[model samples]
Target: MKKQLCILLAAFLSAALLCACSGKKPAEPVPAVSAAPDVTSAPDDSGNDPAATDKPSVPVDTSYNPETDADNLYSSANTILIETEDGFYWCSSTSDYLLFYDNWLEEMIPVCSRPECEHFPDNNVCVQNKKCDAYLEAARHPALYNGKIYYIDSNGIPNPNVDGTRLGMRLFRMNPDGTGKEFIKNLFTPGYEDPQWLIFHRGYIYGMSPQTIIEQGEVSGRTSIIAIPIEGDETTFRTIYEIDNQGWGCMRFIGDYCYFWIHYMEGYYYVNWDTGEIIDEQQMGGVALRWNTVTEEIEILYQELLPKDGYFGETAWVERDGTIYVPGGDCLMKIENGERTVVFEFKEEGKHFVAATVSNGIVFARTVPEDFDDPYGKSEFWVCRFDGTTIFKGELPMDWFYESPEFEGLRGKPRYPGFVMTVGDETGLWIEFGAHWRSTGYNEPSADFLVRYDFTEDGGIEYKLYGSYDDIFIEPVD
Candidate 1:
């Protein structure tokens, strides 16, 4: 009896210990995790014609006014919205209404003038049918070009922060308003993974797919750069370049060639798009590069190294009139003949310019103060001519509630602008003010706000807030 009682006590203590050990800490911030990371999911494909399917249409609530209720626009929910290539502040319609992905209702809602309209895929009277259907589980990464719209259609999986199963991705296309829905091809190939890069360039679609190569029964990974001609058959996929052990390289077509790197902050391979010939391969030793049309060669322009604590990252590159500008150690620098000169710098020693963008013959530089209390720093937006002539400088017309929290003895990310790009004459910025650290093994929650900055002729800038969403990437249609 004494032996049995001791055994039972030991078993109970072991069970309690196991339960306590299973509790996990919050996930680390993104960019500190794996070199290659994946985003969200869509809905399952039924293969039925979206128009032929029958479903009741639900009327979207169009009562929210941004101009009046702008202060009350804070929500912790994940909603999707669409932005045009031109960034003209209106959806692709005549009613001047903005289109949004209603999260709770699982349908596309609009702010159009029509009151009796329904936005479901089966409803023929819905106005959004020409641009997007209600049946789309998740349609994202929109690339508009040549009278057609291209996007990734997914299986509407939840928890877009971490990668779920590859339920298959459909590369679909339609008209500007959403009519003439046509299936392009399935992006998912058996045994391949991490379809992260996609762009339309010069009458063709460029993309990268990471494939697991099984060699001698051992598994390895390889990233394949593929090109699909827009006019050619969708079934015909061609490989432009293939590299092994490369992770998340930025690919861009600046001028006469396509520029990309195999790994981060390494050398670049410049290739002529017309012919699959490697024009030049050179190491930049920096985060980004630019094509010098005068010298007919590429130059490593920007190289901003973050601190050792992994709090912040490098900003986007800005180019104008064949000249490139980037954020450097403490100032904005312009690259000339592989040499960088200070284009603009802050007088304060603690302040640093990190993000640079160009639009309408003007270069915009975003700065932040590094006082440790606000390591993410102040969002001071400055504008200048392409020749580095400073014009306008002021703080952005917005306030922050709370920034990302600093871990124990580790730095945290303050409010900072992630991607700054110019779409037509207007500039679009993706800003993150608050980030909730995940309790699981993943990173921070995938949420960010989009802001549009319109620079007027009088040199005054206008700001427009586009709400928040989870991992929505907006691009200008070429």
Candidate 2:
């Protein structure tokens, strides 16, 4: 009778899975023509097996420290990069493999442990060799906390006992050496869309999910902020806040607060999902907000109606010490303890400060023409101390691109240089450089290299290349 009951439960779950998938899109979309089998995993059953609880049984180490900067914490939604004392570990932007960059050596290598592994797919050599221990298929929002690396595998593992059924969007963790990987929990099932902008802090994972709603023959999207404990399952998932309109939401972390910005259309409304209370209703423009991780309270930092030009400007960045830097008309303003002060001002005739980022007692500011036709037009930058002392001011040099040996053969194509200033510190400013492959068409940008501008004591700047993406593009390793 027990065997019959288990079989009946399996059949019922399969039926439910089919019904769920039929009504909504899959949890993570995969290529339809792929030869690889669907990635899925067995649903964790903690009640049946003590070992299946999916929580780490070992005590967490309290000494593990991670960078709390907004740039490092929330680089991108699809990529996972984390810094440690040893080096940087990130999921490969071009493939399903994980890679490590040695800060001292300034070299990148696959995170594989095998001495002679080529880190490539070879079915004949090993079964599904591409899916190695270092492989993170559809990896998102990876974090290093308490000596373990936790991440979500949007492309999940398949259950062997249940055909045509998947566990769907699971959380996992492994050692820094890419060993002892264990499944944590099924975050979301097949019906719900995968979470975005995941953040791990204070023993909980916070994320946002986009919800599609259609009313009166019109379609729109809403965003829901959620939180779940690291040791908990889907049953513990909680919706903290919800917005009534789709918008560009960027989540950043500083100290005990999670800061985010939402640029919505046709105004917006904030709803506290837990209490079913309407929080705020804004008729125009964007809003800056911060949520306290300890108190679970949401606070609005700033909001403004749409400007006549419709440009809402960039989002404000908060420092680790709780200081906020907001971009005013032509100056960068710093707010601390409810006191506002102008840190840097663009005094040029027809230019204004477009964006600014603060890190390690340094402020990097950029200015652009107030009336520019092309969004990618010429822009200048300044590196200054927090006390308003300028260290360097100039436009980034791109002449080295045509002369560098790395772009020797690729120079024949119509390539345009693109640079993104990511972070700055006492050592220098870190910028990521890419090239637009105009020959291929628009939107085809190549990952070129990551460069740093070292600040000399004499106020001179020196360029250093940290890593290059030439191998990934010049020679296809797949």
Whole-model lDDT for model 2 versus the true structure?
0.52
Minimal lDDT window, size 10, model 2 = 18-27
lDDT of 2 by residue, 118-178 (tens): 5543211111245355566644566766666677766555532234275546788776556
Each prediction's whole-model lDDT (CA): 0.38, 0.52
lDDT of 1 at 129: 40
Listed per candidate, the RMSD to the true structure in angstroms reads 20.9, 15.4
Residue 351 shift from truth in candidate 2, angstroms: 5.1
Give per-residue CA lDDT, model 1, range 1-478, as digits (tens).
3233323323432232111110000112222112221111111122323345332231212232221111011110012223322222122211112343323233334322223334322211222343323233332234444445556655433322224344555666654444456876655432344545555544445555666678799655566555454454443344544444334444544423334333322234568788888844332223344322122233333333333322111222334233444444445555455455566654546556654543334456566555434424456777666566666666665533232123221123333333322222233233333222233434333333445555565656676554433321223111
- Total backbone clashes of model 1? 11
CA displacement after TM-score superposition, residue 49 of candidate 1 (Å): 39
Highest-TM-score candidate = 2
Which residue segments of model 1 deviate by more than 4 Å? 1-140, 154-168, 188-193, 208-224, 234-237, 242-251, 254-347, 355-378, 399-448, 455-460, 466-478
